[model samples]
Target: MTGSTTRLFAARLAGTSVFDPQGDQVGRVRDVVGMIRARGPVRVIGLVVEVPGRRRVFVPMTRVTSIDTGQVITTGLVNMRRFEQRGTETLLLAELLDRTVELADGSGPATIEDLGLDAVRSRDWQLTRLFVRRGTAPRGLAGRLRRRGDTLTIDVDAVVGGVLGLASPDADQGATNLLAAFEELKPTDLAEVIHELTPKRRREVAAALDDERLADVLEELPEDDQIEILSALEGGRAAHVLEEMQPDDAADLISELPAEQAERLMALMDPEEAEPVRRLLAYDDYTAGGLMTTDPVVLAPDATVAEALAHVRRSELNVPLATAVYVCRPPLETPTGRYLGTAHLQRLLREPPQTALGQLLDNDIDPLAPDETLQAVTRQLAAYNLVSLPVVDEDGHLLGAVTADDVLDHLLPEDWRDADEDDDLEGTSGKEAAGA
Candidate 1:
């Protein structure tokens, strides 16, 4: 499974085994690290290797004796410390794969498909070649079948600027290629990718994402990242993104900003969208009112099962919100008329479509008070085996619901969002690990 090979491509190096001089398996390559500059070959710094215990460590190119078939031979001396990328380092696969770069002499834009590294001297390597596909990726079947742009390998020097050009921080390195590459990733996973990028690049990517997508990603990101990305956007766009986020989540983030800045963003948001977030902001952070989302499933008691089902089936509704339908007396929106009871999806499904939600209301459990403590909320949810508990005011107006997820979010450590998930690393030779 190993032999010397001079020819190599950066994309091909991913997940290749790294062996010590005696052929003892040490780890597998997750990413190739390099220092890219404005107008020169990118210096290959090392390989990001995932050692046992799912720890990623740095193996300098000097320690690499051979880039071989199915494996890489190392000098055995490797830094076991977890690899923490310096601000200057670029992860070739994570940052450069599918990056848009301009071809020399204005031949137009091309996307980096792969990069080739060569040994220039004793124990030194440089990224000297780029394999690229010209133009934006094809779309429909015709676009896929029709003649696409040429794919070719050229000198690294032939490609200029964009993400590779660290010398120009403000240069508009569009995120088309980056977004295309990661389009399938979920919000949480995409947040992890964004977490590794430089501040400038992060801003570029954030600007490129649609407001709703950006909002979802922001909700999953660390607080600092959320603020940084939000701060980078124009005031109007930032407000729009806030409107897309869950009211409770948006309120939490806004509460962290300076009072003046928060007010400015709030003023820019549509009054209708700002109202729920503003209401959530007024509650204590750990109370039921603060943790609950103001946009839960709420309907008048006379609303038919079919009508409730239509709302529950909406693609935008989250799991906990869709699990039940709250029935009230008059108004249907949160903080509406007298709180009656809730109808779980199971009962809704079994009941006739024409049956009024009021007919199947489950009044067994008492609703939570708006000012209920977090401890009280948790006890209620646990005691009733409920995913969500309705919250109401003393005057009997239905407020919102506190879901299990919301409770878990507050119960976890403050840094829980920042901590990397311990995904099982049982299989080797897969896509690069997150944070690598």
Candidate 2:
């Protein structure tokens, strides 16, 4: 009579009753939250439910006792607060419902009519399968997934799909066409969208972007997310993205991975690019050695201001918040040379271009020891009011440099990466309640 409920579509799950063990109605299913794993299928992490007084709460899949017959039963314990979507969370209703996606196992593409969810014997909720309409979806479905449905159920194994695009009132771009539109987005803004997509869709977009652009987006992501996205990409492609990243950022991501895994990724990179990261990996994550990037502009101490400026211009190094060039002695190659002193951009502007940089060097500016603690590094950056600080060994040889942005990444709140997303949406009017 109900058109077979073996696969419970999210559309139907929406507004369904959620009850406690005693059969007490707790709330209604508001949204489904999931974590996009680096490999394998995306996993259902929890559920967003709306209780009395219009409050949203997170109920982990593990806490869910059962889901069947248009009813969700939970363990009763619930945190009463509006659900704040983290950078890693994807709201099924908001991000995936009705989106066009390619069906797994060669079933062609289909509009994600609705997502089918089920509870296991252990009472953990998960995406058991998906429900899609097998028909020509509207072209250019950018932000919205679907407008209507035809009702076809597919098993979990047969449902691997990526975002074709959302069919929303705002934009009409298809899933395959999504990358170009996303390319035009600011890195932070694109980071938000990538945050809301599953790994498959994320990888699709990642592949579409050039190494430099993808590197920019990856830089804007959190360490965990940065690793996840990189992990999903092919080794060569991942290496290229890493090549484009600032040495410190790349090292930061690589350091989080297992040694063997890290080695494998590094192997695929260009030798010159790999050299700096390999050196960076030798430092403790909380130390200046670990925080510094080898991509800082470097010039021979004997070089003139013109040469120093030229070096900065010619090198495609993407150092963040960088405004200085390190003057080193002799070998101006990979794995570093003897550090002489630092020279800021302001110094270059004040001095004539032909002025020999060695004369203009600020050797009095204290250089950071590789083993210096993060606190010490922060203090130094703050005290000097410098955009970048050099890291050196006991011999005063330059190993790398840490930029102001790198310091902020460590000092800011855990959610700072996506906090601005909420800020951007603040003034815009939307009917959907905070978690609804």
Candidate 3:
């Protein structure tokens, strides 16, 4: 059955059984599980098999031999007595089940209901994990819903009933239908669907998505989509999404665009909003300096709580929503400012505003050279858990700044390295491959 249905919908495998070579029933498949790596499709690693009248067993895919419509085939024909009943250890299930999984086609979230496994061409065969629909069903369900506009609310009892051949009686059928429909969506169409959603809806969709699928959709999006979606968000919502994106990416989206348009969007945003973007705009778009932002929270070491509060109020207009405040002296002999340490915002807020900034200063802030590569900057930011890193010239003068978001944009799927490699390869070929 696995060979006959190489592309079977994962949701339809909920009730599928597993068997050994001698046609002996082993266990019923409970869930399919694996991690999605950077190199390929989701790799299936094991199956959570529940044997009737017995405990559950986590059968590694290495034990699978083949698959068919009614049952999965395994390598050894062991007796039912030989099967070990493992306790309810959901480690395997937890690894693969109940995750906020996404459909590769539409990049939408679909709950995993169970896993299906079969061994074919290899000793270990990881089967695909089944996905069930939950939460508020997608809109326009008249043609899509199982009962024509009826929402399918998933619960533990409902899931158990569906697997045990009770309840709605058509749950598997409904899931299969939904999976097929989702598979039909093109990448561009998926992006468009995401784009039309409201900010909350967009976040839901993004959160439901896996990183690679999200990256694929992001790669295909037009520049406008990038800017509009990003500009509308703030804090972790904006940061997480952008973090998954490449630095040059977020930069490119904001670069060369109308300054007034960006300004308008920033004006409407809170300090967190206007700051990161404004920092990016400060860069040259073509140079590293042009790609940086300067919205990190800054402080003078001698500032008191009252003074800090005053600074917060005054600088609130330009400062990024920051986790730490940097302490620095104004530029002495250079155009840019000298290097300093940092202070925690939480600490400052907890103290009286009149507290001195110097006492609060943490003097251990990591600083970045303006010319550092985006990759280097990303590593530093991650190491410090910083929201933004200061960029300075060799003389310890501040140039601008680079936010975590900027680093993320550059790290995304823009193919800068590949493009360079291709250019180098073409140069080496020197009309040989071209002539051929």
Best by TM-score: 1
Model 3, 1-436: lDDT tens per residue? 3454343434444446776665666666644545443333345565555444332345556666665566767654222221232332222232333333334444344544444443434544433335455432333222133322222333322333232222111221212232232344445445644553344445444544544455456645656566555555553444444444443444456453477654444455455544545555655553446556544456566767666565556632333435556667874222336656666667878897677777776657656775666667777777877767666777776655566555655577653311211122222221121221
Candidate 3 local Cα displacement, residue 198, angstroms: 20
Worst 10 residues of 1 by lDDT: 427-436
Alpha-carbon local distance difference test for all models:
0.79, 0.68, 0.48
Give the TM-score of each candidate.
Answer: 0.73, 0.58, 0.33
Q: Which ten-residue region of model 3 has the weakest summed lDDT?
A: 165-174
lDDT of 1 by residue, 1-436 (tens): 1245655788778668888766678877777899876656688999988665555677888778888778888777765556789977888776776566778759887767777778777568888888888875432122223435899998876866532542334345456445654566668767866876788778877877888899999988888898998988889899999999999999999999999999999999999999999999889998999999988899988899999999999998889889999898877787889988999999999989999988999999999887899999999999889999899999988889999998998999877754543454332322232222
Higher-lDDT candidate among 1 and 3?
Answer: 1
Cα error, candidate 2, residue 280 (Å): 1.1
The digit string of per-residue lDDT tens for model 2 on 345-404 reads 778888988888888888777888889998998888888787788888888677778777
Ranking by lDDT: 1, 2, 3
User: Number of clashing residue pairs in every model?
Assistant: 0, 17, 37
The local lDDT score (0 to 100) that residue 59 gets in candidate 1 is 82
> What is the lDDT for 242 in model 2?
90
> Which model, 1 or 2, shows the larger TM-score?
1
List candidate 2 stretches off by more than 4 Å: 1-176, 313-321, 419-436
